[model samples]
Target chain A: MDWTALVLSLKLAGATTLVLLPIGVILGRVLAFHDFRGKRWVEAAITLPLVLPPTVLGYYLLIALGVASPIGQAWQALTGDTLVFSFSGLLIASVVFNLPFAIQPLQRAFEGVGQDLRHAAWVGGLSTFATFRKVELPLAWPGLLSAAVLTFTHTLGEFGVVLMVGGAIPGETRTIAVSIYDRVQAFDTAAAGIMSAFLLISAFIAIAVVYGVGARAVRLRG
Target chain B: MGWAHARCGSVAEAGPGGAGEGLAVRLRQAGPIPLSVDLACAPGQLHALVGPSGAGKTTVLKAIAGLYRPQAGHITCGPAVWFDSAAGAWLPPQDRRVGMVFQSYALFPHMSAQANVETSLAHSARTERAARALALLTQVGLADKAHRRPADLSGGEQQRVAVARALARSPGVLLLDEPFAAVDRRTRRRLQQDLAELRSSLRIPILLVTHDLDEASALADQMSVLHEGQILQTGTPEEVMRRPASERVAEILDLSPGV
Candidate 1:
């Protein structure tokens, strides 16, 4: 097992999950409650990265951040460095790929919080933010937590996006997925098998903890 | 000192249900439509609105509570303009000092019984909120259940918590929506007596909406019969029953010559 690549994968997954959690909450609540033009289109757009070909996504990302595109130039000017072929770039790619995993469950959960509860809150003189914090958030906590866990695991397993954009740079963007790919490509089946075993065990442990906590919360609520 | 004393004397001398003494809610929503009703509950009296389901009885209550925006009408409670569609003056529910006990008992299921009651107090100190809530629970005979959740309580217990919550604000007008319907028969009778006692102690006009005439007669000092979104008659229960303003009122009252 490549310890550095393993640590890098963990860090990337952790960072992606942390960044996506608040964004997922906002997106889920908006999609669940708000009525607006182009909402369906907006939802489709958010989900597109999940289904889009990873190579095509990587190509677009590569081009957009290659210092030729206006966005890339602007970003370079702001950060004094290019985002392409970096750890940060891989993190961004993983978040985009796993967004739907973080959002769909939460949106469904929030939608299930019936309008009667919200109407009662309105009559009670609660402001919109207060109602969300006090009513919607508590009701949707289980699904939101599950979404977070799912996105984290999905990000950890992400290979195609990281491979194309991250370029498998050793110790910088060489996540465990890319490291395993490297071992396979080099015909080192033993190392590849070890990495695969670690990934499987870690993914299983993460999912088990998530479901365990979610089940406990549901039981308590009942 | 003399003029002030004289003024106080004249104010006190006015008879019960005198001009500007009780709530007057006459509201119209939209179009040429008009939804109007009038009542003068004497101090320390229970007034009731009895009607079949979907008679717009809840509308009338909501209008008075400032939850409804009427097209045209005025609601005056005592000297205050709760809602005057003509004058365009409206007071919010919180400002009106009106306590409402909802039909579903709308107890905050998340909070304990005491906290639910304490919600009525705007400026209640943390220490006093619990004490005052407990006192109200005791008055409603649920002091021992103050720490219990509404879900843990029986239907009757939930209703008592609702009543205690309504009284927590010391409202000038208490609106009860089928307050006794949820409780079992034994609890209902006990609650009825407790409500009557509460009415006397609070000395506030009570407006209760119910479909049951027996319950209305048992509790109301004044009764209004409504049918199909209109008031058929308003009078003392005996008078309304005996000399109904319309045939519908008579039918609704189920009045008989002997009774």
Candidate 2:
């Protein structure tokens, strides 16, 4: 079974989830409450990953972070390492691909918190940050948990975006999904089946935790 | 009773210059209506804003609380200028030192009554927070229900918790939007009496928004009759009830032709 690939996949998903959670929360709050011109366009752009082909997103990131680009050149100059075909590149690719999975649930959770509770907290003399921490975070924990789980599972199952950006480098970017495809190409049916089953079981457990345990926790709190 | 006396003493110590200067609001327009109101409530006094459901009464309270900004106006509570459109000074709700109880009470559903009250005592020391919150809940007659969440409390109990939470900071002004609209008649009467006693103890201005004429007449020291976002009449409740400025005001008050 590709244990190296399995470990790499978990590492990538863990890193991506850790990075995406805060970004998702901040962006979700903005989307949930604040109104500004072009907000709809911004939302559409954020959600584009949910519908757009993963390779298309990967292709854009490839050009944007490639050695020829200014960002890539600056990154290379600063770190003496290129972004393309690196674990860092794969992590960014996974985050972008899983952006909607991280943000949508969080945004819904914040919206569900409603303006009344926020207003109450404000009038109660709590600062904005305090209110978000005391009231919003507690109330929106279930949705946040769901968002985190979805981001983690989605990153673990990433195939097209990682394939496009990371290019199946062994022990570095060859995630489980990529390894499964490589196993099939190599006519290694047993290895492919093992990896696929592992991914399927992980997805099921993550989803069960979110729907079964998370919902019950929220209900019990109420 | 001890809590009330303690609060009065604290208020006096906070401002020795007598009851702190009251809340004054002058707004050209607020909310969706072309609202314009120039009203004031003296310290230690309860001013009721009486109007129909959509007559901008709650909007006036929100503007004073710094929750809603008027297009052209200033709200001055005590010595602080909460909003001044021309000077571009606007204090957000958190900085305004204003406590507001919505019609629905709007308590934090997940928190117990004590936690809800403690949240308002942000300036209190962490060690003193629980005691202070408990004292305030006792003042509102909810000391026993301090550990109960809003969902578990009755409407009157929840309202008392909201009142306790609002009073936790000794706010410069208190705004109540249809405070008794949700309670039963007996509970409403008791809450009204409790509020009246509370008003006597609190030196800061109190603004009560309600559509019920009886509520305004019973509790308010000064009453303003609003119609279509305009103050149609402003006077003592008895004066307003006895002799409305116009037929419209009388009709809105539901006063009989002779009375």
Candidate 3:
């Protein structure tokens, strides 16, 4: 099968997961624990990607990172390389499209770590920061793991967004999903079939891991 | 079961090195369990706030512990001003050096019993924390289960661990918000006995909030009756039971006049 495409997909997913991990955790925690005016609006905006069509999202992202846009112009000036049709542009697109996949699990997990535990920690002479590190983080570890795995798995299978923003450039932005589509267009059904099976199995295993962690957390919470 | 001496349990008797005198509070709020309270508990005295569910009993305890801030209040604990709304002086919960046993126990499920207690020893030396935590656990009769997480412990054991953690910091004031409400009757009795025994060693005022009047009379040196967020009466449980001051106080206590 297309090994380079496979490798590129893994690398991109890995980078996206690494970047999303801290953002998801902070956003998730703030959303879970804090009350603020317009919180519902903030929550709705975060969950928008879950409902937004991928191609529609990709089209917006394409214009946002196009040569004429501010972000696109700045990137070219700073890096001397245009963002459109580049792996960096694809990575940014993947991050935006995959926000729900990274954040929802973490928010749910943080919410599960009860307010009583946090209050108890604080009254036990632990600061808010200390309580988070010592109590909330440990309790929400399963959610964090699930968030990472989901983000990685979802990014690896990203197709429309990557294709829209990065095109199908070999070795630069052609992920396994894009490669499979290219193979199918060339009538390379055998290669497409193999890659699709691999993606499907890996996605299944990733989801199974998330479910397993959630179940274990629930049992432990008992 | 022999709670005869427990009624007067160690009263701290103005004795040498008795529980330190602290915990003076006045609070006023309009909603969310609206509270109007003016109360004080001396060193070594267990003051129980007896009330119905919406009487703001837990909120009173939380206010003393610096966990909840009322619209206006002041709390003084052993020469330290924990909160003063007029002055805009509010100590965060961590700095209050207050021990609080939540109704739910609220133990860190991920930490072992010893570690849970050890978390309160943040101010103590690192190497000494384990032994100190063990000592506290042993005091609560959970020495053998130090390595077990909260999930492995029984409800009673978890509550005991929460107590041990609260005591680890040698707090200036202790707050118990229906700490025994979740356990079995037998366990609750045992926990009450444990608190009575441990009360002698603590040099801090304790504020207990409970809906159970019997529990209040059995444990509190002085009890305050709260209704609709207002502390209607404060006296020794015996005094309150015998003379409820108002018809409303008698009704709240389920006591008939002259009974």
Candidate 4:
């Protein structure tokens, strides 16, 4: 019933997906291709958010983006505003939390593109950038679509990190997930049930699209 | 008429002492076994590199193509120095002007046959790219199949498309790594004939890697017998067939000592 929160949640999810896609692609390509010292450490650090408790991640983000920190100080200096408890803070937190979801699938897809095709492109007189665009991107499109959808839906349902970082600013940060919790705490079970159902159905449809359409694209390519 | 005349002109310019000065590869300690190979192929010649599996045949091709950096030595194709360890000059594959046909025919699966060839003509004028791609496809007898993706093409067709795509660059050297290993005998013969015609028309140095002795004998102007990452013999097909350099070379070639 809280239309504002639903719309805000959608906006946050969209912004988070837009911000994460390119970072995910670059990180995925690096993880897929390059071999270097401490690569395992880099990989472990990237995947840490997936296994860490959401509240733990939220705790770090809160400290890191607080007015006391260097990043927060720089933001305040430039924009005359604090980063903590802001919509931008929520977007950043969601990107960090959903990174593994975006990157792992893309890494697998780039790997599936294989070195042979890249070498062939090189021998065909295509530059590295041209080859990535002409060959890797087209071949790995399904996985990229899956990554984008996963990031979007995951951010939509975000609760712990959003709750910890953004709190409950009704018009600004009270997403659908937080609104459901607020309704339940206020003993408004009817409102909570409606919001929860909406989320459940949205998640289902997003997942179905990825599986039904994305998987078919991958299969057709193979 | 313009394209055909241009093609002939390029071919004439590439003949013997022009753009077809040939490829000279002197590589050392490149792969496993401290491989050292000294080989050359002149213009208008098909030099076959015959060796058993793991004998570093593909390594030689990669070295020539600038995909593999040799520990010591140089790779010169026509007038360009692709790699020279002493000069510390190394050209990447995209800059080396070398065309390679992989054994698996590494065509872009998402691209049509024409687009696959067009990727090689990235340096060509944008207005003439499609026409040039079509001309190369026609040269390989695939003009009608230009719109077909690699998945829709047969194995022989895929190989031909790869050849056309390689030739689209007008490379100074051509490297075929087991190009016919995947097709049947009839398709293999047809592809071989097509390649022979391509060689005669292009007049560029071509180095072919094959395990089949008959294929080598039938197509190669000269054959180099390699074993354990070393060139044991280099001579005409009849010379190597009639007189292998040593017992090991003979054994590797599967030829009787008396023969």
Candidate 5:
């Protein structure tokens, strides 16, 4: 099976999850706790990725991060490398597309921590950062695990966005899903089958771990 | 409007043991739990705010703890001026050395009773925090269950943990909001007695918000009857019960006229 492609996918997914974790937590907290003007619009904008077709998302990213765009120019100026059809470009696409997966669960988890507990912590002399680290993090760890697993799994299996932003370039941007597609295109169904099985097993194990740990977290929070 | 007329106005009588400037509070609001409160609880005194559920009693307590801020108010405790709307001065709960027991207890569900109390010792010497937490837990008679989480403890036990956590800071002011409403009668009586004893040793102003008139009469050194966000009268519970200032006060207290 395409081992390099498998490794690339794993690295991309790991990096994306690590990059989005802190951003998701801060954004999720703001969304969960505060109510201000235009809140619904902001929520809708973040949620658009879930409903938008991967092709549409990819097309937007292609324009936003393409060589002709300001971001692409700045990226090239900073790194002396083109962004389009590169691993970095693909990584950016995966991060943007996975925002909903990482943030929605985090927001729900933060919301589960009621106002009484927060007020209690405040009166107990816990500062904002201390309260988040001590109380919010411990109580909402299940949601955090869910966010990571979902982001990783989704990145592994993504096809449309990967093909659009990250072409099947061996050992660079080529991921397991793209390799499987390339295998099928070359009439090599056997190799594609093995890669797909590997992916299936990876996803099953991830989901299983999430349920195993999430159940214990909920029980402990009681 | 005037301190001399109020029985609780003996601010200068604070003993040397009493900490700081007691608590001075004046608040006004038109909506969102409307409140017009001008009250004082001298150092070493326990003052009860007695009113119905919607009468801004808890709001007043929350305001004192820096959990809620009214539109216009001035709150000063000990040497610190907590909030002054006119001067744009305000301190968040962490900055205000106030300990509070919420109605729901609000103990960290994931932490043991001892750890929950330790959360309030944020400014203490780290090496001595555990001993101090155990001491507070012992004071509340929950030292045996120090390692038990809130869910494993009974309602009374959880409430005790909440109390221990509140006192962990050696606060300048202590606030309790319907602290006994969630516990059984036996637990309630125990907590009441504990508070009665605690006040004498704390040497800090203690404010209790409760809807139960009997609770106020039993535990409060001075009590204020509040209605529609306003203090109708402030006096000894005996004085308020025996001679309510107005018919509204008598009605609020469920006292018969001429009694």
Candidate 6:
């Protein structure tokens, strides 16, 4: 079993979780509390990336980050590099692809905490930022944890996005999911089986932690 | 007499008189029928605004707290003008420094009684915050429950902690909206006494909004009977109880003119 693939997959999932957390929180807050014209349309747009075929998202991301595209050209000029076929590109794709998995739970959690608490804090002299930080975030921890766990597991198992954007590069973009595919292609059934087992265990552990924390929050709040 | 003198001294300490000085407010919001209010609160006094639900008792408090901007009107507290339509001066809630205790108690569920009180004193030093919060909780007779979260405590305890939180900032004015409606009767009596004692000790003006006339009569030095967004009458509670301004006021006050 090549440990590097497992290690890289873990790194990618971890990084994706970290980067997506604040974005998911902000998006969840907006979706839960903010009232704006075309709010439903905006919500659908934010969540669209989730339901769209991963391969389609991957294809678009590949094109958008390819050397010929304007975004890729800008990247090339700024960092002397291209995002297409890179691990970083795979990460970006995974974050977008798994965003709703992170956002929906958080939004639901924020909604459950209700507007009354926020209104109270506002009148008590807490600023909007302070209210969110001190009251909203702490109260929504359960939802946030669940969303993060779901996103991490989803990102860890992503095949289409990684396959299309990562290009199965060894030690660079070759995650456990990609490794499993490579092993199956090379007729190495034993290695593929081992990687699959580990992936399942990791996912189970992540989900258990999420549910564990969420249940505790419910118990405390109750 | 001792308590009365102490109360008088506290009022003097609050300023020249101790209670809020000539608090007046008028609000006109945007709608087909805008909200309109005009009333004054004397110093060292508790004025109860009793009305039916949606009669805009809460709106008056929110307007005074700078939570809502009226399309037109003014609110002047003492010599300092909180909201002046002519000058376009509208102070924020923080600047107004008015303490408010909500019906839900709104004690931060994550915080213990002590911490909740401490948060009200953001500008104070950490040691002073803790000390003041502890003292306030003790004053509210919840010193033993200082470490318990709002969820862990009973409804009455949470309300007391909320009152402690409101007083932690030492605001010149206090606003309580149905503060005792959620508590049991026995607890309600204790809370009512605590509020009365607090008012007797501090000389700060209090504005209490409630649907219950009994609550209003018990807590308010002055009473303003409101219905349909209008103040029907304003006077001392005893005077209002003795003389009804109109048939409607008499009916609402649960009173009748002398036979």
The C-alpha RMSD in Å for every predicted model, in order, reads 5.7, 5.5, 5.6, 5.5, 4.0, 5.5
Which scores greater on TM-score, model 3 or model 5? 3
TM-score of each: 0.74, 0.89, 0.92, 0.90, 0.91, 0.86
In the range A145-203, model 4's lDDT, one tens digit per residue, is 88999999898898988998899898788899999999999999999999999999989
| Maximum-DockQ candidate | 3
Q: For candidate 4, lDDT tens digit of each residue in B20-133?
A: 357777777844556778787887889999988888899889888887776887887766888888899899998888889998889998989999999999879999999999
Candidate 1 residue lDDT tens string, A1-222: 889998999899899999998989999988998889999998998888888988888888788767797866887899887777788778777878888988987898788675544543434444467668776787788788889888888877888888887898888899999999999999999999999998898889878987897787656444
Order the candidates by lDDT, highest first.
Answer: 5, 3, 4, 2, 6, 1
| Candidate 2 C-alpha lDDT tens digits along B84-176 | 889999999988888889887888878999999999999889999999999998888788888988888999998999898888877999999
TM-score, candidate 4, is 0.90
Compared with the true structure, what per-residue lDDT tens digits does model 5 show for residues A1-222?
999999999999999999998889989999988889999998998899999999999999999999999999999999999897899999999999999999999999999987788888998889988999999888888889999999999899998899888888998889999999999999999999999998899999989988898788877867
Check candidate 5 and list the clashing pairs. B21-B78
In terms of lDDT, the poorest run of 10 residues in model 3 chain A is A46-55
Candidate 3 lDDT by residue in tens digits, B38-90: 88787788999987777788878888887789998778775588888999999
Residue pairs in collision within model 4: none
lDDT of 1 by residue, B161-255 (tens): 88887787777778888888777889888888888778777767789998878778888888988766567788788788778898778777774
The per-model lDDT (C-alpha) reads: 0.77, 0.86, 0.87, 0.86, 0.87, 0.80
Residue ranges of candidate 3 with Cα displaced over 4 Å: B1-20, B255-259
Model 6's lDDT to the true fold? Answer: 0.80
The per-residue C-alpha lDDT of model 1 at residue B108 equals: 61
Worst 10 residues of 1 chain A by lDDT: A116-125
The model with the greater DockQ, 1 or 3, is 3
Off by over 4 Å in 5: B1-9, B12-20, B31-33, B242-259
TM-score of structure candidate 1: 0.74
- Interface DockQ of each model: 0.15, 0.53, 0.72, 0.63, 0.69, 0.36
DockQ: which is higher, 4 or 5? 5
Q: Which regions of candidate 4 are displaced past 4 Å?
A: B1-20, B30-33, B255-259
